[model samples]
Target: MSNQTFKFKQFEVNQDQCAMKIGTDGVLLGAWASIEKQPFAILDIGSGTGVLSLMLAQRSSAEVLDALEIDAMAYEQCVDNFEGSPWGDRLFCYHADLAEFTEEIDDQYDLIVCNPPFYSEDYKTENTQRDLARFQEAMPFEHLIESVSKLLMKDGVFCTIIPFKEEDQFIALASALNLKVDKRTRVRGTINSEIKRSLLEMSFCEPARSDDKNVINTTELIIETTRHNYTEDYINLTKDFYVKM
Candidate 1:
């Protein structure tokens, strides 16, 4: 696959040499990760193509943004993308696993976002690059939670998108590390379909009044409709990155 340049509202991502190309999961996590007050330091775990890190750069005024990737190809692609971006000075991609990055970094981050591999099944693909980008064997839920628990600051927000079926289990894992879910949004292709993915934001301290289930859109015509015609909300959410969205 060739490296392609994906244009966003405020940035363009050049992802020619990445194992995981631009996908809905990365775009959703990038657009959905909250940066309300603007974080000072941010971390993107398993940063493939550095899309989420770039999105966070556009969303907040963070001085330092770092990305950690275990895959060598993805790490190189991330470094290239970051260096080509305007925020190259502040954005750095480390060619290391998440656990290693967490152990070496002494600084805490106010925002930590990850588009983790959640497909915990006994399956394999012919494409080794995609497998490395999509598989979560090296970094399980427990391992990620423990690493984040140690790296996240007192008021930090750890954001991620996981399969809806694993939300309960994922939350349970995070809770073991004393990280409570502050906000979550269950996404569906349409109003009638079952929820497919859950975008969650967690923090060390439980909110005084935590809310549940912030449904984003309820449109039936997107998936069932023609290939080219997408829903308004879906288009709105991804218009910035997708070429024709």
Candidate 2:
């Protein structure tokens, strides 16, 4: 769990240079994000160590797997990791602010994935880079959704992971931009633990909702039945990426 290199099934991520090291949230989002559309281009916003982009590259035939990392150290490391990955030819990293990148990039993506900064609290840590990576002020949900709404293709899917408490608010914001929820999974560490995170899949195009039944497919995911004893669903969802799943 130290800020060091993390080895996966098909690839290894060097995280020594990144303030925000690899975590379960990013891995879960990468593995759970649907790629059924067979996207040709993919974008990973706030890519951190570029692990999400790497995972998608390994799972799909995306010719263009681009990652955006604003932090200088993380961005440089992301580029290096992308170059070292097996999908080096397909993976590319952009070291620019998301707001600017969204404005400058004219091409739309078939799939857009993000493990965005979630915290919106007023606090500061001794380590500024970590704070920037973890806090919402660095890239608020508003800006993230606005950019995704603009950059996503007509049929493209946008997937992300956020706090369970923020699910309602986030979905409401997305709805305002005409992004409808396709699927949602509430995540918990253990069966007894309160819901911790939410995995969301949204798109610009969605069929009309039926009054008789729910339109957005929703489910619950328990990561572990007990400490280090992963649940069957959790293993199945992340086995492709985790080294010892």
Candidate 3:
């Protein structure tokens, strides 16, 4: 296991030497994933170092939680993290792609979460391993929709985060797969910056109230402000995991 610990409000994630390390995107998705009323079972696609899975385990009362990772190294790391966590018995990691796992797996989950690779055409690094983890060619938007459509239970919900620029196209693809946008959050880096990411939760049926936006400025707006200091709202939202706010 990696020696790095991702301290959260109630838990700490030890992620080191994993192909996909813990990042702001995963943290936001983990903290933002809707677990209202609690879910009986949950799934995390592209589980990476299992940060989202760990976060869900800490926040919800789900009895069964599973994570699927296509990368061999990441799958192993996820398994290790799960085994070391308090919810070890209830959490499991599958070393297979989503499409392949869905074909043989029969169980359905109430909630599913994913922080998928969104850089479809972005320039990739020379490292093939890192490219596989960061690039989108491994799992395109279309493929994600199809896989989620097949894996999610009739009453289940699928949640994910993507680049804000892809919002319109993502919604269209989800619609084609029979999934409706249940909730949408447009996130901005700062008050002055343009929207950069969109956190989406989709269901089989349309939500009565769905669209919402949140402006999260993680860093200090003024030069006198110290780094790592967060706003009140940001602190409140992620206080559970970050050791220092």
Best by lDDT: 2
Clashing pairs in 1: 3-16
Task: Report lDDT (Cα) of residue 186, candidate 2.
Answer: 95
Per-residue lDDT of 20 in model 2: 86
Error of 1 at 207 (Å): 10
Candidate 2's error at 86, in angstroms? 0.5
On a 0 to 100 scale, what is the lDDT of residue 241 in model 1?
A: 63
Give me the displacement of residue 11 in model 3, in angstroms.
Answer: 3.1
| Model 3 local distance difference test score | 0.79
Q: Which tens-of-lDDT digit does each residue in 1-245 have in candidate 2?
A: 68868999999999998988999999999999999999999999998899999999999999999999999999999999999989999999999999999999999999999999888888788999999999998988889999999999999999999999999999999988989788999999999999999999999755656653437899999999888999999999999988898
- What candidate 1 gets wrong by more than 4 Å, as runs, is 1-3, 206-227, 243-245
Across 1-245, the per-residue lDDT of candidate 3 in tens digits comes to 24577666565666674666788778788888889848899999999889899988988889989999988877888888888888898899999987889889988889989999877776878877678888888889899888889888898888899998998999899888778787777776665677788888888753435563332223221111235555565666666877775
TM-score per candidate, chains pooled: 0.86, 0.96, 0.87
lDDT of 1 by residue, 51-148 (tens): 99998887679999999988887888889889888888899988988777777879999999989887767998998887877777856889889999
- Sort the predicted structures by lDDT, highest score first: 2, 1, 3
Name the regions of candidate 3 deviating beyond 4 angstroms: 1-3, 206-227
Q: TM-score for candidate 1, please give it.
A: 0.86
The lDDT of each candidate is: 0.81, 0.93, 0.79
